[model samples]
Target: MRNMLPAAITAIMSLSVLAACGTAGNESGKPADSGNSSTAPAASSAAGAGGNASIKGKVTFLTNRTDMVDKEYKEYAKRFKEKYPNAEIEFEAVRDYDKTLKVRISSGDFPDIVLVPTIPNADLPKYFAPLDDLGLNDKIYFKDYKATGGKTYGIASGASTVGIVYNKKAFQAAGITAIPKTLDELYAAMDKLKAKGIVPLASNFKDKWPLQSWVYDLPPAIAGTANVANDRIKSDAPYTLDGAYAKSFGILKNLHQKGYLEPDINSTNWEQSKKDVASGKFAMYLLGNWVINQVIENGAKSEDIGFFPMPYDNSGKINSPLNPDWFYAVNKNSKNAETAKAFVKWMIEDSGFDKFAGFIPVLKDKQPELAQLTEFKSFNPTFIEGVPDNDQAIATQNKAQIDPPAMVQDFVLGDGKAVFDKFNKQWADAKKSLGY
Candidate 1:
């Protein structure tokens, strides 16, 4: 594993010069070129201009999250209402989204607008509407979501970049300055903090997905490159496992053996994990930009925290992968497709919505009210910044496994563990209670 860091650099995604208007990376924490309209055509098309009339319809929103405190979908509905007065928004929140959606869609009680966290399945035509024919996919160059050029299903609603969120206060206490650039340095710092009795990685395996990220996150190693995310998805191919991923998991297993994770990762839930980390129980955690908003809501000072990309290698290159991570889809049987589409369009291009939403918009030219109080901008490092590698292959493997269907739902509710329990339960379908 001595050459692990250097040799792996040639395996990660190559750095692309990020422009505000360019669509290069997946949900990687790269800076985009900025400047565009303040509003969408339905609302803030040219800024400071109001449309004369509003269209009306009742659009049902099928969502994975049911938490009103989160306010992501509600912010969407509110902005949509402001833009279109005549439209009525009815939201149907699914507590156990996987089981619920399948049953409801089967029953034919479909919503007008639907939001999918990530659909690993490429056969979206059987489920969602083709945005290409609708003309939405025509003008936009999305990094993922293509079966055929003409059969584009949905456009991603909000994009959030994932990074290693570390507490500055925690770093200062250890008298260790600077974010770790290599795996060895990261572990060394973690050991230092551990000696001081501080947990290194605040983790909750009860949710399962967060930790599963260790398995799915590093495709550059498995795919042998980082840029081919979409190609792998479009191909009728089998999953492959090897390389950098092998090294990455070996690292995770060592962490588990070293007790760097929680006391019992199998039982640690996300709620307790988040509380512990925010209270400084852990030194660092791999978090998405969504955690920024969560921190604010939880009463943490923005300056007390900082974020950086996860660097698996020693050369200080940041992994900026462009993933269609959080996607919103329109129901194929929606009577309010036009209104639903209008709402989605407005959310992406609207500065007002972006300010509150705190996510990167998918539109080419957008006026994003991004927070500058954070150092995330200078923090965008390309793993290719120092190493050279064609990352397209890695990107392809990423898109394929990162959002696999069997992986997502099964782990979320312990369905995965149940199904994997015994050969006798092998044929048992991953089904939910009628109440869920």
Candidate 2:
């Protein structure tokens, strides 16, 4: 249940711009002296730009892989190092990452490559560099999506499938014989687990957004079904979050009222909750590939975990949505923009695509091992074909609305009867307002 939840805001975004901004060291020793301060990057002597005369400059990256204390993103960083042996690549793991990214953009000291954060549209434009002007157009895989998202802004570092992750051992122990195919079954299964004294759902509510993903992640699949007009789910359409979200909420609320979600779900620490399930105390969680990695690595036998495709719209039918894991971007201001582009090219095209780094690469060849946790293949979609090609329209119609605005989160976090009453009235009003 909680494993299906998205991690943190900063953790997920910066990995896409992994080569970009990182922790900034106040190494000038001139710190704590003035208000107008700046972080001077450690210099490198490596050659860059068409094999220039000893290119020695630092490319700061923003990441939290600092836990890999001894091992850096050694592979990709190593290649960049060889190309510019004299350059000292200073990898910075910024604390309070969301704020740090904003500070850099304001200080005129932005990272060479910065992540285009999904921050509800507040700070995206200034930090993101458009790939179109760089001639990266021809090389990108989604030529169908070429002109779509306005700016080629940046490419996702990798992609993942979003769904519910369950403990196979827990399910077996609880004597629950099948994965829940629809909302009702999911509730009934949770009830069965509760009777056994097992917490049916576990997640880090403190991290906040993990809970948020429940609200946001699922709308795209159900809403995408009508494939609505102008690529938009009509304001009057029955399946839009306005229509469907409350219904989803009602389902989740039914679970909560029955005590399926853990008491104090908000109190759980993210790492520990995930570990708890991997350790087999909690039975279910919602998550994507990242959680799968944790379950497998944490001593859980390979066959012991189940990743469920969430049941949406009461239909019990499977409709998986694409989860964009991460994307890459070039610094518009860099003097060696072409070489930077070349570096991005090397990542997705050659060894970069299939290499087992911390991420699941999106390129065509060698993808990280996409393991199936259950017999339900539809829970994990393999392609983006036959889907509405509009990017924001797709997000608006399907995903963004899923959690709170959509049905998923409301059922988990809000007043169920209230959400239903409110949205249902809103939908009815919209029909009249549309004058149809």
Highest-scoring model, lDDT: 1
Q: Give per-model TM-scores.
A: 0.68, 0.65
lDDT of 1 by residue, 203-289 (tens): 555565565345444544334344333333233332222334335555655666687777676677665565566666776776555
lDDT of 2 by residue, 120-163 (tens): 22224445545554343443344222223465656545555556
Q: Give residue 402's lDDT in candidate 1 (0 to 100).
A: 32
Which one is best on TM-score? Answer: 1
Per-candidate clash tally: 26, 47
Model 1 stretches with alpha carbons more than 4 Å out: 1-54, 68-76, 95-108, 117-122, 132-151, 221-224, 227-242, 315-318, 351-357, 367-380, 383-436
Which residue runs of candidate 2 sit more than 4 Å off their true CA positions?
A: 1-56, 64-79, 93-109, 119-126, 132-140, 143-151, 225-242, 334-360, 373-436
